[model samples]
Target: MNFPDLQTERLILNQLNEQDTSALFAIFSDKKVIQYYDIDAYQTESQAQQLIEFFNKRYLENLGIRWAIRLKENGQLIGTCGFNSLNEKMKHAGIGYELAANQWGYGYASEAISKIIELAFSSVSPFCELYRIQGDTMIGNEASEAVLKKLGFKEEGVRRSSGFWKGEFHDLKCFGLIKPEFKAL
Candidate 1:
């Protein structure tokens, strides 16, 4: 299947290719950007390339999809957002995203995410059957939490020691947006 490309008023959500390696690395390599992320800050361009390959592999296998978030005006890749895990039979998916630290506070994350949510809940989307989309944020990641809340995800409480990364387990705040809730937005 063709990779789906989505758009918002000021951003474009499209496939991540080799050409995006540098930009992708730049985002993931920033310590501030990955402070709340599960993975450590990328130290090499190969790490970023591997991530791109992993995302594409997930899409090819129908397990998930991640879009490169780019600026419409300059086509500069700023970050990525998409379902981290997708189970069509269960009608549920887990979402993930990250943005360049410099790009924070501009509502780009929210705008890009809103578009993804719309498609996930739309009848014409490949993800149309998805009934639930969830996100998990490390404790203290207020910025991410606010974005999720702004997009209509309800706080579903914290999962103690539910995530293990960066050499230790960390608590994760769960947020969920069901199709009904999304449609109501």
Candidate 2:
């Protein structure tokens, strides 16, 4: 299947390719960007390359989709946002995203994520089967939590010690939005 490219007023969400390796590395390598991210900050370009490949592989396998968020004006890759896990039969998916530290507070994450939520819940989109989209933020990541809340995801509860990374288990704030709850902006 062809990768679906999505667009917003200020951004473009498209496939990650080898040409994006350096930019991807730049985003993932920043300590600030990955502080709440599942993985550690990237130490090499190869890690970024591998992540790009993993994203493509997920798309091909129909497990999920991740888009490189690019600015429309200068075509700079600023971040990524999409379903990290998709379950068609179960009609649910888990969404994930991150941005370059310099790009924070610009509402780019919200803009890109809004588009993804629209497509995921749209009857005509490839991800139409998805009835629910969930986002989990590490407990202290207020920025991410705010983004999710602004998009209509209600806080389900805290998942205590549910996530393990950075050498210890961490609490995750669970948020979820079902089709009925999403009001497109």
Candidate 3:
């Protein structure tokens, strides 16, 4: 299937590429942005390049897609949002996202993620048969929790010490949205 580009009122979610390394690096290297990302802040552009390659690989393998979020107004890439894991046999996938510090508090993450959920649930040929999409955030990440809640994801439970980050294990608060829940929205 062809990689799709998702659009919202103020954002365009497109595939990431080499040209996006600098912009992505700028966002990923910021402490505020990566605070709850469960990964260390990038230390160089090469890491961003590696990330883009990883994203492309995932797409090529039909495992997931990580769209580079761009503001339509100025064409500035502000963040990314997409599936990070897929289980076709189980009809579920894991969702992940992060936004630039300057783009926070503007509802961009929610808008972008809502679109991804919409795509996940709609009958769009070979691309939309998922029955559930799950997301997890660091235990104390209230902002992420609020975003997931606003988009109709119900918090399931916490996975104690499930994620290793910052040289320690961190509890993950899991949220899930089933197909029925999404259809009822």
Any runs in candidate 3 off by more than 4 Å, and if so which? Answer: 125-128
- Of the two candidates 1 and 3, the one with more favorable TM-score, higher being better, is 1
Best by lDDT: 1
For model 2, residues 1-185, the per-residue Cα lDDT tens digits are: 67889889999999999999999999999999999987888999999999999999999999999999999999999999999999988899999999999999999999999998898888767753888899999988999999999999999999999999888999999999999889553
- lDDT measured at residue 41 in model 1 versus the true structure, 0 to 100: 85
The regions of model 1 sitting more than 4 angstroms off are none
Q: lDDT score, residue 166, model 1?
A: 90
- Scored against the true structure, residue 96 in model 2 reaches a CA lDDT of 97
Cα misplacement distance, residue 26 of candidate 1 (Å): 0.6
lDDT, ranked from best to worst: 1, 2, 3
Superposition error at 22 for model 1 (Å): 0.5
Model 3, 1-185: lDDT tens digits are 67788899999988998999999999999999998877888999999999999998998888988899999998799999999988888999899999999889999999999998888888882453799999999978999999999998999999999989788999999999998988787
Q: Please state the error at residue 180 of candidate 1 in Å.
A: 1.0
Q: What value does the lDDT take at residue 84 in candidate 1? A: 90
